[model samples]
Structure formats: C-alpha cells, structure tokens
Target: MNSSVITPIGKILNARDLGKLVRDLREKQGATQADLANFAQTGQRFIVDLEGGKATVRFDKVLQVLNILGVELTATRRK
Candidate 1:
C-alpha cells in the first residue's frame, strides 16, 4: 500500500505553507518536534501545531523559528 500524508497548506484557512517546509527540513535532519521546539525557544505544543499546519502563527514568530532551524528565506521577483 502506498499512502501519502497530505499536510495542510493551501487547503486550510490561515495555513502557513512554511510549516510544511519546516516539517520537511526537520525530518531530514532527524529532529523531533520537541527538539525543534527547544531550538525555536517555543512550546512543544506550538511546534506540534505548526508542524501539523494547525497554528495561527505570527510572521515574526515564523521567521524566528525558521532562523532557529537554520532555514533561510530568500526573495525573488517574479519574471
């Protein structure tokens, strides 16, 4: 059986697409939610909600967490 997990991104209300990106990166680094939460200096529940794509996170907090996870954000103009 091949089953894929679909994370909430563009499908949910106020869903942060970056959450999925963070979750993927964390998995690649073999880091647990608790580890990420500690690294991000946030509550584990917050991390869980973020990873689950169920959190209404603030932009600054999102950036902070991304920075803590060593995830850099780059901007580019549309061609």
Candidate 2:
C-alpha cells in the first residue's frame, strides 16, 4: 500500500488541487468518506468539505487527513 502521486508544484496551485489529491488517494485506498473521518477523528461533513476544496477548511484537520492518507505536502521556493 505504497501508493503516491508526484505532480509538479504548479499543478497543485490551489485548495482545489490539494483536494483532488486527497480524494484520489482516498479512493485509491478504497476508503469511504466516513472511514477517513473516523480515522481523522472528525465528522463526515468535515471530510466532505475538505474533499470538496472548501477554502475555509481548517489547516490542522487538513494535515490530519493528509497524514492518514499517506500524503505529504512540502513548500519550496520557485525557481
């Protein structure tokens, strides 16, 4: 279960991009929104909003979901 995605920085330029990644990873693992929410200790509505790319989503929860989905986001200076 070592699935991952490698996209150029520009490809994921917004919350929507990040959400797509999360949704993809979640689906890849055959996980339902409820499953992810339970693992992240949050409500299923939170998962819905997170996966829907709602800009106001909580940062801490976003990190938690990413952690559970085995996704890591990094920051780097553009060339």
lDDT of each: 0.71, 0.85
How does residue 64 of candidate 1 score in lDDT? Answer: 73
Mind giving the per-residue lDDT tens digits that candidate 2 earns over 5-79? 465434577788888888888999999999999998989999999889898999999999989987677787778
Model 1 weakest 10-residue run by lDDT: 5-14
Runs in model 1 lying further than 4 Å from the true structure:
1-16
For candidate 2, the lDDT comes to 0.85
> What lDDT score goes with residue 37 in model 2?
97
TM-score for model 1? 0.67
